[model samples]
Target: MNDEVTRYIDGAAPWQTAVCEKLRLMVHETVPEVEEQLQYGKPHFLQNGDHAAVIAVARNKVSFMVFNATEIPVVKGFVRALGKGDRKCVDIAEGQEVDYAALADILRKTTIAP
Candidate 1:
């Protein structure tokens, strides 16, 4: 785990902090060798030096993004496509539940080769 990324999560709102931690754990579990960093003021997870996922926190919600996930199926909590449709994001607000297992499956299957 990267200290900068940890600080980013620690600085978020309570609810956002929880969501960020969960998302971080999911990425780490899915990709044991994943690298973490703080990029663009958000926490970014990389696999084999390529971006695998990112976690961002805003005022009202936390956003989890999967990279190279254009083929990933749309599921509950997925709010939008990003990065020229090569990425997808799930937004979670306070009290909302996120399918971490599903997101982990997507990460396991996604090829972060770019």
Candidate 2:
């Protein structure tokens, strides 16, 4: 993990930490080349010269925030997790189960696009 991401995760609550760790690892697995950084005090995953995505710990959920969620399929499946998003974010509760393979597929399809 990058120092920025480590710092961001360290600042979160225990549940947030767990969720963030899972998201972080999932993002890395899906896009190993995306640079991890701290943006707006949250962990951001960026593809070179492309729009970046952010993940943050919310009061009741962890959000995987994407710039264009309508363009991604996973956001639709996560109807329960979906919230009012300026871009489009997949907010997942700590206790809720996440489909890792599916999440990876969404991330891959969304982030790799030009």
Candidate 2: stretches off by over 4 Å: 73-86
Q: Write the per-residue lDDT of candidate 1 for residues 24-78, one digit (tens) a residue.
A: 9988888988999999988888888889888989889888888887787676547
lDDT (Cα, tens digit) per residue for candidate 2, span 3-38: 978988878888888888888898887888888877
Scored by Cα lDDT, where does model 2 land? 0.73
Compare the candidates by lDDT and give the number of the best one: 1
Summing lDDT over every window of 10 consecutive residues in candidate 1, give the lowest-scoring window.
Answer: 105-114
Q: Would you estimate the TM-scores of all the predictions? A: 0.90, 0.79
Question: Best by TM-score, which number?
Answer: 1
Determine the backbone clash count of candidate 1: 0
TM-score of 1: 0.90
CA RMSD of each candidate after superposition: 2.3, 3.2
* Candidate models: Cα lDDT each: 0.84, 0.73
